[model samples]
Target: MPIRQLPDTLINQIAAGEVVERPASVVKELVENALDAGATRVDIDLEEGGARLIRIRDDGAGIAAEELPLAVSRHATSKIASLDDLEGVATLGFRGEALPSIASVSRFALISRRNGAEHGAALEIDGGRLGEVAPKPHPQGTTVEVRDLFFNVPARRKFLKAERTELSHIEEWLRQLALARPDVELRVSHNGKASRRWKGEGDLLSDVRINETLGEEFARNALRVDHSGAGLRLHGWIAQPAYNRASADQQYLYVNGRAVRDRSIAHAVKQAYADVLFHGRQPAYVLFLELDPRRVDVNVHPAKHEVRFRDSRLIHDFVYRTLHDALAETRAGSAVGVADAQPAYDPAQAARPDYNWRVPTRPLGLQVEETRAGYAALYGAPRAELAYGAPAPAGEAYAPPAGLDGPAPHPALPHSDDASLPPLGYAIAQLHGIYVLAETADGLIVIDMHAAHERIGYEKLKHAHDGEGLRTQPLLVPAALAVSEREADVAEREAPTLAALGFDVTRSGPQSLTLRSVPALLAHGDVEALLRDVLADLREHGESRRVAAARDELLATMACHGAVRANRRLTLPEMNALLREMEATERSGQCNHGRPTWARFSLSEIDRWFLRGR
Candidate 1:
């Protein structure tokens, strides 16, 4: 074989191999083109899962009669004209290969009226052969019709899935587009029957749209997020830990209104949810990342499904920090979707505790001093000072000293209206030796007493440990660990990050490192495992949470062992004290093990349960 120029038809067919994977790929390209043209509404008609026919009509600025031929010409596009335009492309269809490549494998027609033109024009291409452009009757927008997709390439056509499968693919892509552009109306018809329609919505997102797209459950549990920093804006909805999914199918990411899949941002999100989400569960989110076009490269993938960021580390940190702060606010009383109500006082219930006690359970032998020390900051004073305090004599029913009590009962105002009342309301009773029953303004709240106290203790331990900095434990003799040259490079380059994480590492050779000191909190743990995980994380994500994660694990164990145990009797004041501390804690909704600590049973739901609503 000798070097030779490929024919235009063969070249387009080859390009189609990259841009057109199936019916879904074709829809993705043409729909993106419609959106880029400034369409506010798009109508799609598919036959035989878009294998036999695909007609897309959009109310956007249309192509001109003279430019009709160039619209289907390879490497010719109105989207970009220079290197500068390519470098900072804001449009969805800049490659110019979609129309030509799509036209090469199917019967295609392009017709438009240029928004304000007197008459529409049409151009046809069959199997890469073009016909003359001619005047045609149409509306003030563009209409692209493709018939017999992959008709010229029998092999490709044979590879397509069944009718229902292919239609599902097209529907999925349209769903993604709908999420990104809620302001754009989209209607779909299959086999002459209207299947679905997404009405034009307000702004980038809406709670109604989330419910309609993802389901009512997601909408109810969704947490609204809108943050901007360093010329980047990220806004969307994230499901609370209580509503997480087993798979990541519900996670959607859009970059500057273009849907894409970036693993770096995905990993960052996962890391943000690491402290709360249950093991083996995935979080659901619909996040949109908006940054200056110059800061991101969208030409990396053949289909523009992935992007390369200029400052990936910065973006990662920004995303992680934003969501981390948001989740921290997911404390006990700031219920995501629960409505607030005025306190409804019932003096009788406040005095008469619910004695739903269970049989004798194994006690954890928790100490009053330990619990007091861990929660001292929540009230006032240091752990050292609180640790010396003593509990009231045993066998005394629920009565504590003055300092170990909740707010004083007000005589004039409604009991819960007092300024000292926390958001979780006041504890009314203990249930089944394991739960705390509380009276909110609207209804009853059941709390897992042990789980709640464990979280409170764990968070306090973490705060105290972090505030002291990452204290290092120096080894009498340094130890050398061999690793890949790349790991050695990361250890050398990220020395500052490593040091901040309480690591003193020096490169001993091209593929080895000497460890001088380790985090004092984790000195007794696996030093080799910790260093390897940290280096791996830094090398890939430009950051590592292993140090903090390790330290947290130890504190969590301590808190769990020291937390108040089941079957422990408590007075109203003692229980109220726990409630106040929980109300003031961060991430108190879940324990350190990712289990929920409390749940709210609304008044309406209770009414329905008792058949009182009827």
Candidate 2:
């Protein structure tokens, strides 16, 4: 066959194969167009899961009567023009193929009246054939109606699911949109009945949206994260480790106000929650990242659901460090339940914790100091220092005291000034020899003794072990490794980064490497395998955490071994010391395994539970 050009309608139908996959895909493209038009309110009316009809109305700056014909033309868009505009497109709908592509496979009509227009105009397209523009009375906005989706393409229509299933997909996509934009009012109607609505909350993002989208529990456990640095800014809410989900369904990332999925960013978040989250549990977050539009390429995906970062390493490091530090500030008692709302905290006036881990009145068996000493001997490293201002090893600084029985109380405090009581409050008694019962100002507190102690020990172990940075163990003979030429190039280029991570990597040939040393903590395990994994990570994310993750896992096991065991009897003073230490420890709300270590039961809730307030 001779080379020939396809008809205009054929070209659009082919593009529709990529842009219009289902009813949900059509909704995504049209709604994005609405948002780009500066629409504050968008009403969507769907019939039969949008297979039979989909009418989208938006109060935005509409197109002019003269431009109505070009609006549905292929390769026409108001979003971008020159190459520069394509490179740094800030709007959500930049590709001009959406309208034309969608119009080709369905019955489409577009009516609009620019905000200041004297009249309105409408145009209809049936099966890619255009109709003359006709005068139509419409408000100062745009209305797009699509009917019989995939009517011209029977093969594609057959692949669509049932009505309920298609509507569910639309709802899910709308949820993603709603999270990224709390200031936009969105309403949905199915079969002429209202299905859902998200009220506009302005640009100032608050927990009300989060509470409505996720749940009251998530908002209650959420930690506000607002940070900016190095030409980038990340601000949103991340649920505490205790409120993790079973899958990645709750993770939402928006780059420059456009929802997207980037594996590098996801990995960074997972790494940040590594130590605190339970095994196999996914953390919940609604994060929005903002950076110069030029630094990211959004043209990679047809749906624009992913982006390529110019400086992936820089972005990954920034995200990891930001979330890591924020989690570090998740001290015990910092989070508040919805019912226990209180005045903003003033850290300046906060009382410094005086954890009385000092010499007890008498000898007590099974002190934490003994556990640390035992582990220090087992690992042949220096005895560790305790956290929360606990005294150091004997004769080094302040030797931590462990009294299985004796009590060492604070000197004095004015009872009237309740601010002096630490956030975890003082332990009053033990329950079932496993739980610690404490009293707070507003209500009662229940704590898992072992879980709480395990977290405290883990933090101390990390500080003591990492105080001097990662230690490297030189191999007796440098090990040779084989790899792709590109991988080998990455290895050679990132030699300094490898060195900082306690690795000595040198390029030997076009596709080979020489490893002279490895992290001391992981030197025994196949160093070559570790090298391969690290190189692969560096190639993609521009950074690697395989070594650190291994090291932390080992530390976590040791911490678990050294933590106080359940069913162990505790003296009043011993329990109080543990509570105070919890108050000062980082990420103390959860154990090393990600389970919450403590829970607060407010007076109001307690009253309701017992029917005292009913």
Candidate 3:
């Protein structure tokens, strides 16, 4: 058979294979088109999981009556025209293939009336057969009705899941879009009954929207992030380490208002959470990255789910550093005050139909050194003195230090309205030889003694390591490993990076390499496997931190061993000193293993426990 150009109908059907995967895919394309039309409110009506019927009515700038036919034509889009426009495309539906592709596989009808138009026009297409445009009654907007989706393509229809499953997919996608455009009002109905509604308002996203989209738990545990610099602006909420998920289902990332899945960004987020999250657990967040549209390419994939950045390394470093700095402040007692008064769990507040919660505010940065100095003066001891432990009888009652039964003022300590209430407050007792029970101005604080100490030690070790870089240990006999030419090239090109990471590598042959030295901290690791993994990462991501991560893992182990052991009794002074040290230390909220070091129960929570509120 000789090669020939495919028919127009067949060509559209083929494009449908890429743009229309299921009922959810159709919804995604149509909703994106509506958003691109500058729709403020979109009403979605579906029947049988959008398979039998899908009607989307949007109050947006509708298309002209004369342009109705062109809307169903392939490659005819109002989004972009010239190469410059394509390079900086901002709209969601730029491909212009969705309408024709979708029309080819289903029964489609588009009716629209421009604002102030006396009449509306409708264009019908059934399985790629276009009908003449005719006058129709319509509001001052656009309404697209699709029936029997994929009806012409039995194979495609067969692949669709059950009605409930398809409906769930549609809902999930809508939720993601809702997060990106909180200003766009959206409502969905299934089988003639309302299923979901989001009333858009305000210039910025409200906490209520977060609660409705992500959940109340996330809204309560999330940290507001707003950092702008170096031609990039990242603003959104990131979940605290304690609020992680078993899977990464809740991680919603958007680039320049378009939802995308970029590996470099994802890796940066993972690296940022490396020190705080458990090894297997994933973080939940709704992050938005804003940058010049020209700096990123959105047309890399037909589905438009992925993007390519011009400066991936710069973006990665920026994301990593911003999140890293944010997580660091959560340590010590800097974040304790904010965490204490986080929104309480309210089922009714979350379930309310009207989303109108006030936006949560982020705390102003506090001077770490100044706060540490204040804590040091109040404790009347150095961090080193507080680190040592003195053995005491287990389960023995802790007696307050002499002349410290009540609040005592120290001239060296800064005076404020809440001067008496230190962030962690004062230790009152010990629990189970593992937890330190203390009283704060707000409520009770329970601390994992071992975990807290482990974090303190880990931060100190990291600081020391940072001051005197990684120490390299020369191998008595250099290890030789065979590798592919690509790996060898990477090894040669990244030799400087390896050296900086305390590794010395040299190419001995065309496809072979020799490792002469390794970081002292990672000397016992599988050097060959480590090198292979590092090379793979560098080749793919243009950067690798496996060596540094391995070193950190070893440091974490040392910190764990050096931390205070459970069941080790402590006197009042020792416990109090530990509390003060925790307040002054960084990343003290979590241990090296990502477990939270402490938790606070507000006074109201205590009241509810005993039904005192009733």
- Judged by whole-model lDDT over C-alpha atoms, candidate 3 comes out at 0.81
Better candidate number, 1 or 2, judged by TM-score: 2
Which regions of candidate 3 fall more than 4 Å away from where they truly are?
332-420
- Taking all chains together, each candidate's TM-score versus the true structure is 0.87, 0.88, 0.87
**lDDT (tens digit, per residue) of candidate 3 on 4-101:** 99999999999999988898888999999999888999999999999999999998999899998899999999999999999998898799999999
TM-score of 1: 0.87
- The lowest-lDDT stretch of 10 consecutive residues in candidate 3 is 349-358
Clashing residue pairs, candidate 2? 391-398, 392-398
Question: Which portions of model 2 miss their true places by more than 4 Å?
Answer: 336-420
Q: How close is candidate 3 to the true structure, as a TM-score?
A: 0.87
RMSD of 1: 7.1
Best by TM-score: 2
